[model samples]
Target: MTARTDQAEITALVDRFFLALDTREFTPGWARAYLTDDARMDAPVGAKRGAEAVRTAETALLRFARTQHFASGVVTDAAFGTDDATASWNAYMVHVHHSPAADPLFVVGGRWEATLRRTPEGWRFSAMTVHVVWTRGEPPTAEPG
Candidate 1:
């Protein structure tokens, strides 16, 4: 595939990933769609490696509360290497929850850096790192019409 096509595919994959999480669909099949077998994820809890580990971590996270990851204003930089590529993007996220029952929580905009490898399964994320800019909690308010 051409570079543009590859980049587009990756972008779609990233979007789907966040969408699935926001909808609380933590199925292994869905989680594996974008991550490689050896992928690793790092969060406040800790680091997890491998597809199964990633799935487990995600499931636990979703159980915390109802969440939505709004990935707005994505800026991607794709670097084509000999056999693989790396792409990074910054996104603005609003993570809502019902724990406090006060206001929806917002995770300030953050950056996502991923290393993708061209594989038989198509472009897959071999490594992903999420850098959070800030976090704040707001009292729950009526949903906007």
Candidate 2:
């Protein structure tokens, strides 16, 4: 594939992850579209491995009434020659708590780094990590410990 095509695919994979979470999509094997079978994921709520990462993600998401995520400035260090690559981007997310809570919103901004490997299915994350740069509003009262 051409560089632009590779870049586009990598960027789309990154964007698709946020979209899937915002939509709360848990269709069977959906997580595999984004993560490898042995992926390591570390986020605010917890750390998870492989497809199990979706469980931690969904649990954290259920605490919020709604959630929105935006990813931008994606930069990829393409090593498609080796069928692997690394990418980083900035993210801004807003989580709205269930009504009746005193503080109903939690906002967080962070930088995310991901290692991707190309499998027969497509590009999937082998490892992902996020570094919190800032946050506003209070998080959900019932976050998993």
**What are the per-model C-alpha RMSD values against the true structure?**
5.4, 1.9
lDDT of 2 at 21: 92
Q: Candidate 2 at 35: error in angstroms?
A: 0.7
Candidate 2 steric clashes:
0
By TM-score, the best candidate is 2
lDDT of 2 by residue, 44-100 (tens): 777899767878878888888889999999988777467788999999999997865
- Which stretches of candidate 1 lie above 4 Å from their native place? 72-81, 138-145
lDDT of 1 by residue, 1-145 (tens): 6677776887887888788776776654665677788988775445788865676566545544656666554444555565577777777666556456555464556787888777777778888778877667652343322
Best by lDDT: 2
Give the lDDT of residue 15 in candidate 1: 89
* Residue 74 lDDT, candidate 2, scale 0-100: 92
